[model samples]
Target: MLPPTQTEAFDELPLVERARSGDDSAFTDLVTRYERKIFRLAKHITQNEEDAEDVLQETFLKAYSHLGEFQGNSKFYTWIVRIAVNESLMKLRKRKTDRTVSLDESIDTGEETVVREIAVWEDSPEDRYSQEELRGILEKAIDSLRPAFRTVFVLRDVEELSTEETAVALDLSVPAVKSRLLRARLQLREKLTRFFRRKGDDVFAYL
Candidate 1:
C-alpha cells in the first residue's frame, strides 16, 4: 500500500509523457522509480528469486517495446504491474505442467475467523528477527499459500495496491479480491500464530 507521494505523482507525468514519446532515459527513470516494488511483487508471486528477476526484466522489456500500446487509462504503475503479473504467471506455467488452482475457488473456512486483536502483534516479528531471517520466514509463509490466494495477498496487502487496482492487475472482481485477501490474511495469521506459539512465553508474554 505504499503509494507515490504528491511529489512522486507530479514527477511521474512528465516521465511517462517523455517515455511515451521515445525518450529512453525517461522510461529508464520510470523503471528506476518502480523496479524494487515490482521485483518484490514478482518474487512473492514466483516464490523464486531467479524467476522473479526474470519476470522483472521481461516486464520492463515488454513495456518498453510496447510503450505505444499503453493508453492512459490506468496509472503507469498499474500498467507495468499487469505486465509483471502476466510474466510471472507465464513463468509459473512453464515451471509446472499441472493445473494451478483457480482464483475463483472457495476458501477453506474450517478455523474460526482470526480475531483482529491477535492480528496486532504488539512486538512484531520484525523487531525480534534480523532482516534476513524475517524475510525468509515471511517468504516461507507466503509461499505456503495457494497461487490464487498468494497473488491477491501480494498485490493487495504486500504491494499496498488499492482493492480496485489489485483487482485490475489480477483480472479479478473487487469482491473476489476482497474474498481472497481475507482468506489469505487468515491463513497467514494462522501460520504466524503457530510459529509464535512454538516460541513459548518469550514471544507471546503479553498473551
Candidate 2:
C-alpha cells in the first residue's frame, strides 16, 4: 500500500517500530486502533458477517507474520488495509458468487454521459421514514454495485482513504481508481435517484 502523508507516517512510526522489534503489546495496540475499521471494510466487501470476521482475523494474522517485510515505507494502517482488502476479495473468489468488473477493461459510461440532477434526501421525508429505513435504502443501493466498483467506493469514499492509498490497496493505478470511483458514484446516483423522488425528498444535488 502507498504510504500515507508525512504527518500520518510520523504519527505511526513509533508503534510500527516497536511492533517490528517484537513488542507484542505494540502490535496489540496497532490492532486495537484499527480492528473496527478493518472489520467494517471487510463486511462492506464480503456482505456477510461471518466472512467479514474471518477476513478480519486473517488480516491481522498475515500482518503479524509479515511485519518484518513492512519496510517502514508505508503507514501500518495502510499496509493492513491492503491485506484486509485482499483477504476479503479472496473470500469472494472462494464463494464464486460475485462478478467483478475488470479494472483494465474499458466500459462506456453509456452512449451519452450527461450529468443527472439527483434529488437529495432531507432529514425528514414526506413519507415519514424511520432512520433505519433510510439507512436500509442506502445500503441496498450500495449493495447493488459490482464487487470491483464497491471496493473502490468503500475505500475511497466510505473509509476516506486517499486516491493514492486506495489505488495501492487494490493494486490499481491512480487513473484506474479515479475511473472506477466515477463509475461507482454514477451508478449510485442512478440507483438512488428514484428513491429520493419516491420518498418526496426535496433539494437537488449533483452526485
Candidate 3:
C-alpha cells in the first residue's frame, strides 16, 4: 500500500515548501492526497473509467517531471488539477477522433434524459428514489456534452471551482467559461425536460 497522501501528511504550505525543495516524499504525498480527485475529474471529462485512470497516472507523472518548473503562483492542488484536466481533454479529443467514423447515426440519448426530470420532485419517497436515479442519469447526460462544455460544467458546477479557477484550468477567459457553462447547463436542462414533461404532474403532486 502507498503511504498517506500529502493532504494527510503535511499542510499545504509545508508540502509546497518541501516539494519546492526537491523532496520526493513530499511530492509522493501530494500525489497520494489528490490522486482520487484527479481521477474523478478525469472520469468526469473522459466519461470512461479506463481513460480516467490513465489520465490520472499520466497527470501525476507529468507533475513530478515538471515540479522544477512550478512557479508557486497558485496553490499546488490547483496547479495539479490544471494538469489533470488537460490530460483528460487530450484523451477526450483522441477518443472523439477515433470514434468519428461512427458519428453518422443518431442513437438515443439514453436514461439520463429521463432522469433529469427528477429535479421536479422533492421530499417525497418517489422524489428520493428519483433523485438517486437522477444522479446516475446525470452522469450520462454530462458525458454526452461536448468536451469544452463538459469541462466547464464539471469545474464550475460539480467541482464548485470558482470562475477564475475554472478559467485557469480550462485555459479560457472568464467570459468564455461563463458562456460555456451557461450553454452546457441549458443543454442539460433541455435534455432533462423530456423526463419532466412526462413526470411533471407527479412531481408537483408529491412536492
Best by TM-score: 1
lDDT of 1 by residue, 62-172 (tens): 999999998987888889998999899888877877867455555556343456434344365566778887788888999999898999989877776789998988888
Which residue runs of candidate 2 sit more than 4 Å off their true CA positions? Answer: 1-10, 97-117, 120-131, 195-207
Residue range 118-197, candidate 2, lDDT tens digits: 66654444255578887788777888887778899999887878999999899888988888889888888777766666
For residue 140, give model 1's deviation from the true position in Å.
Answer: 1.3
Q: Write the number of the candidate with greater lDDT, choosing between 1 and 3.
A: 1
Which regions of candidate 1 fall more than 4 Å away from where they truly are?
A: 1-10, 106-122, 196-207
Off by over 4 Å in 3: 1-11, 98-120, 123-127, 130-134, 190-207
- In order of appearance, the predictions have TM-scores of 0.82, 0.78, 0.72
List lDDT for all candidates, in order.
0.81, 0.81, 0.74
- When sorted by TM-score, best at the front, the candidate numbers are 1, 2, 3
Model 3 RMSD in angstroms: 8.0
